[model samples]
Target: MASSEQHYILPRPEFDKPTKVLIVISPYYKAIADDLLSGARAELDAAGASHETVEVPGALEIPAAISIAYRQSNFDGFVALGCVVRGETTHYETVCNDSSRAITLLGLEGASIGNGILTVENLLQAEVRANPDKQNKGAGAAAAALHLIALSRKWGRSGREIGFQPEGIQIAGKAEGPTTA
Candidate 1:
C-alpha cells in the first residue's frame, strides 16, 4: 500500500562548498544495515557529498553518537541508519521512541540530521524498507539531511548583529552617546 502511494521527491540540493556528512549506523541487522548504507552512499555520491560511517551497539546509541560527532567534528550533516524490529517486550517501543526523540532534539539544536532509523513490525518490513532497490529509506534520509544543510547554509547567518548594542556605538547612523575614557 505504501509503495503504491505517490511520493514527491525533491531535487538533490547543490552545494557551493564541499559538503561532508557523518553516517552513524547500528548494525543489529547486518544485512539490512548494509543495504541501507549502500543506498545512503550512492545518494551522497550523486550529490557530490563525502561521508564517513561509524558503528554503534544499537539503535538507541545512534543519536548519542551523532550528538558526539556534532560537538566534536566538523561534519555538515548527519544520517542515522538502523533497524528496530518490534520484539515481545516493551523495549521495542522505548528504543523506537527515545531514539527518534533524541534525533529530533539534535536537529532542533541546529544539527542537520536525516533519520533513517527504521521502526518496523517485523524483519520483512525492515528488509523491504531498507532495500536500496525498494523503499530506499536510507537515501531518503540522506536527502532530507542535504536539504536541511542547504537551508542552514542559506539562512545560517543574519547580517544584523545580535544582543544589545554597546554604549557610545552608533545606532541607525547616529551616535548613541558620547564615548567615555
Candidate 2:
C-alpha cells in the first residue's frame, strides 16, 4: 500500500493589538466549563489578547451579565460561553434562544458578541466542543471576537466607511492605503 498523506490547516488572520475581551461563562456545567475557560485563555495568550472572565450562575444568567459587561466600558469585543444540555423539560430551548437572541441583538447594534455557547443533546457532544485539541469552542469564540475587534478598529480608523460586507466575509470600501488596525 502507498503511504498516506497528512494535511494541516492554519487559523485565519490575527488582530495585532492589545485586544480587550470580556468572557462571560455560565457555571451550569462547572467541570466542562473549566475547559472552555482554559481554551479561551490559551487562545488569548497565544494571540496576545487581553481578556477578563466573569462567572454566571447558569446559562440563563449569561446574557444579563453580558449586557452588564457591554455597558461597563469600551471593550473591544465580547464572548458568551455557556453549556446547556437538554433536560427533561423545554428549558434548553428558552436558554439557547434567549441567550443567542441577546447576543445577536448586541452584534446588530455594533457590539460584537462571540457566541461559544454549546447547545447539545448530551454531555458527550458538549465535551467535544470543550475539547482543547479538537473543537475548542472557546478558542473559536476568541478568534471571532478578535476578528470583530479588528474590524471595529479598522472602521474607526478608516472613517467607518470600510465596513464588513453583508456576509461579513470581507470589508468594502475604497482601495487606498491600508491602515493598521
Candidate 3:
C-alpha cells in the first residue's frame, strides 16, 4: 500500500488580473461531493478568484460539463470534483478511467481543468481524501487549474500561428491569397 504521507502543500498562486473559475461537481455521493465542493470553494476564495458551481449526475459528466462551459462561458479555468468508490462490477473501472481520460484530453486542448474525481476502494477512503482537513484533493485540483491559468496568461499565444505568409500575413476573408506587405 502506498503510504498516506503529506509531502508538501503549495501556496495558492496569485493572479495579476481578476480571474473567474467554473466548478463542475458530481453530487452522486452527496456528502462527499459537498465536502469536495467546500474545499474547492475555500481554495478559490483564498486565491481571490471568483467561481460558480454546477452539479452533474455522476463523475463521467464532469468533463462534459466543463467542456460546454469552456466553449460557452468566459471563465478563466475550471475545477472538476467527484467521488468514485470501487464497486464489485467493472463499472467502477469504466467510470474512473473514462472520466479521468476525458478531463486530461480537455486539459490538453487548453481547457485549464483541475480534476478532483476520487477513485478509491471504499467510502471511508473517499471521505478521508475529500475531507478539507485531510488530503483535500479538491483544493489541490483548484490550485492546479489556477497555476495553469497563470502560466497561460504569462506566456500568451506561444507564437504558433499557421497558414500565413511569413512576412505578409493573410487577412481572414479578405482574399484567397496572402495579402502583400
Candidate 4:
C-alpha cells in the first residue's frame, strides 16, 4: 500500500566547490549493507561528490564513527548506512532509538548527516529498502546530506567570528576608551 504512493524527490544540489562525503556503514547484514552502499555510491557519483567508506561493528557504532570523522576530518557531509531488523527481544528498540538520537544530536552540532539506518520489521523489509532497484533508502539519505551541505554553504558565515572574542578585543556596544560613569 505505501509502496504504491508516489513521493517527490528533490534534485541533487549543486556545489561551487568539490564536496567530500564519508559513508559510515554497519555491515551487520552483509547483503543489505552492500546494496545500501551501492545506492549511496551511485547517488554521490551522480552529484560529482567524492566519498570514502568506513565499516563499523554494528548500528550503534555508526553514529560514533560519524562524530569522530566530523571532528577529525574535512568531509562536507556524511551518510550512515545499516540494517536493524526487529528481533524477539527489546534490543531492537534500543538500537534503533539510540542510534537515531545520536545521529540527530550530531546534526544539531553542525554535522551534515544523512541517516540511512533501516529499522524494519524483518529481513525482507530491510532487503527491499536497501535494494538500489527498489526503495533505495541509501540514495535518499545521501540526497538529504547533500542538501544539508548545500544549505550550510549558503548560510555559513566563515568570515564572522563566534564564541568569545580574542584577548584585547572590545565587546560590541561597550565603551571603547574610558568609562562614562
What number of clashing residue pairs does each candidate have, in the order they appear? Answer: 0, 0, 0, 0
- Local distance difference test, per candidate? 0.94, 0.79, 0.89, 0.93
Alpha-carbon shift of residue 93 in model 4 (angstroms): 0.4
Better of 3 and 4 by lDDT: 4
> How high is each candidate's TM-score?
0.88, 0.78, 0.86, 0.89
Write model 2 residue lDDT over 2-23, tens digit each, in one string.
Answer: 1133334346447765778899
Q: Candidate 4: lDDT of 163? A: 66
Model 4 scores worst on lDDT over the 10 consecutive residues at: 171-180
RMSD, candidate 1, Å: 3.7
- Sort the predicted structures by lDDT, highest score first: 1, 4, 3, 2
Backbone clashes in candidate 1 total: 0
Question: Residue by residue across 20-134, what tens digits does model 3's lDDT show?
Answer: 9999999999999989999999999999999999999999999999999998899999999999999889999999999999999998888888889999999998998899998
| Candidate 3's TM-score | 0.86
lDDT of 3: 0.89
Between candidates 1 and 3, name the one with more favorable lDDT: 1
Instruction: Write model 4 residue lDDT over 1-181, tens digit each, in one string.
Output: 5556789999889988999999999999999999999999999999999999999999999999999999889999999999999999999999999999999999999999999999999898888889999999999999999999999999997656566655556655453344456
Question: Top model by lDDT, which number?
Answer: 1
